[model samples]
Target: MVLHVVIASVAALAGRSVPSMALPKKRERAAPVVSAASSAMQMQPAPINPDWIIAGEPVARMADHSKSADRAAYTALWDCTAGTFRWFFAWDETVHILEGEVHVTAEDGSVHMLRTGDVAYFKAGTWATWRVDTYVRKVAFLRRPFPAPIAFAYRLKNKLLPAKTPTL
Candidate 1:
């Protein structure tokens, strides 16, 4: 059956045995870790490539908050002054606007006006034009995604052996 083949492939790729019909054992929860609040962190200047700028000078600042255990994901606070520029996404990023606004135009001509409290996602390998009339501040969650084949295998493994929920 297709299901059997999928399970076998996923298990092999994961280098572990997974019972086809059984859930995986729950992982023990680690101690809670806390980082400094965003408001308390100092932002340092992060320069934008001059060649990417299309208009007025835009000053930008950022402060890193945390990174995942695998170093594949991170969170940061960022803010930029008024300017127009082409922005490239080297990794998957989801931004939660905290102050001001920005008008983003996609390569396909789709325009998104993001303001305070708004959220937007930009995928890896994409570029967009950003126009900020005054300022924009946001919390950005970034991740480096797994490759296509590996991602497929991971999904299959999760489907075959669903993760167990830890009890409080």
Candidate 2:
């Protein structure tokens, strides 16, 4: 559910339209997949929109791990230097802090201090203010959801025709 939201949000943020829920015409077997250690993955600069910065210059970096076939979901490693900024969640995002810490203030005036090993979820279409004192790193899981009508149809179809497990 959250994954779908994230994907939708990401698509919006990227100026891309959300993909339809329809399956591809040709079904193909998926290949085995693996990712290198986070420490070994090269991080690329992912600059924050200048207008979103409130205080100090924050430097951000990111490394993508994997993306779903339909491009509706993905995981990535992200980090940032000390700074205060407004983060607009374009997608549903669940983040697991890996290093350092950050203070996040939601639009509702609630504040959360997320440290190493902490996990937090940010809903799509929301905004939060983040303050990173020194540095912070996290793994972000994101997903885009189907439209309401399409989601309902999918749910109804699943209930009517449940998939059967294949015999090994």
Candidate 3:
């Protein structure tokens, strides 16, 4: 409860203004990622590789979004062997390294090498690859999650069903 209060307060401050990257009107439709080549985004790359390290940014986001406030928050850590992460989806997360080192490739191809006692902030929307050498553990938040099995079901439904709008 204390954590929630602090996070919300910070979010109200850090996320107070509308970022150009803020969700668009009628946010039901997710936006596609813009390329790094865009003049504006490319102008100011991080001076240091991991400037965001230890920054508790994106303090609140999709990784924990839920219809029920009762269950709006969730957390997890990863120590997988995938070696490379192809991309990320609709989620804003906080990753606190418990052990090991990770090479984080930003959606823009910017890179950050993080190790123990380091923290990284991932916004609600960005695609990136995470390469872990040893094991990794980090916290995360999610909204409208589709676990592997459930995601598979959704794929099948889309494949089998023709497009249609149903009456409620």
Candidate 4:
């Protein structure tokens, strides 16, 4: 598609290369290990939706967990190879970079750099472009996402009905 070509061209000009739109072969793997920290050596390439690719082949590896069937809370370790791509957040995510670097450009054009030990928050509904300068590794915490109005209401309720403190 024309969009893909445009994205690839723009990325090249920015000194980043993007892979073609062809779907890379998916390799089979065993179930992920649910743990507090990843061993790193066992991480595998994450499955990516083709529609999300922009340029040069960006690949991600992840080990993730969900709190429950309702999808309230989630956590994951994600690693990505050097590449450029688009990310649309549907859940509030807080990421702590463990290795490498990334430059993220928000929809408003503001740019942020994330490097080792840096933490970044992406609210639900945010649109951004992520250009990975080097292979990167991160640990991410994801909270249940809500629409604007619902989110506001939830916050207000929490303030009104605070949890009771236990007396010693």
Each candidate's TM vs. the true structure? 0.76, 0.74, 0.41, 0.66
RMSD to native for every prediction? 7.4, 8.1, 17.2, 15.9
Per-residue CA lDDT of model 2 for 1-168, tens digit only, reads 764675566546544444557777997664468577999888999999999999999999999898887678889999999999999998889999999999999999999999999999998889999999999999999988666656565676577667889999
* Candidate 2 clash pair list: 3-143, 4-144, 4-145, 5-145, 6-92, 6-143, 7-143, 7-144, 8-144, 9-90
**Candidate 2 global lDDT:** 0.88
Candidate lDDT (C-alpha), each: 0.88, 0.88, 0.51, 0.76
Residue-wise lDDT of candidate 4 within 61-116, one digit each (tens)? 88764354445778888989878888988888999998998999999999999999
Model 4 misplaced stretches (Cα beyond 4 Å): 1-35, 65-70, 147-152, 158-168
- lDDT (10s digit) by residue, model 1, range 1-168: 776687566657665432355544875553368478778989999999999999999999999888876569889999999999999999999999999999999999999999999999999999999999999999999999776655787787787777999999
Candidate 3, which ten residues in sequence have the lowest lDDT sum?
56-65
Model 4, C-alpha of 150: deviation from truth (Å) = 4.6
Instruction: Report the alpha-carbon TM-score of model 1 versus the true structure.
Output: 0.76
- Candidate with top TM-score is 1
Inter-residue clash pairs, candidate 3: 63-141, 63-142, 64-141, 64-142, 91-124
Model 1 residue 56 CA deviation (Å) reads 1.0
The regions of model 1 sitting more than 4 angstroms off are 1-31, 155-168
How many collisions per candidate? Answer: 0, 10, 5, 5
Q: How accurate is candidate 4 locally (lDDT)?
A: 0.76
Distance from true location, Cα of 143 in model 4, Å: 1.0
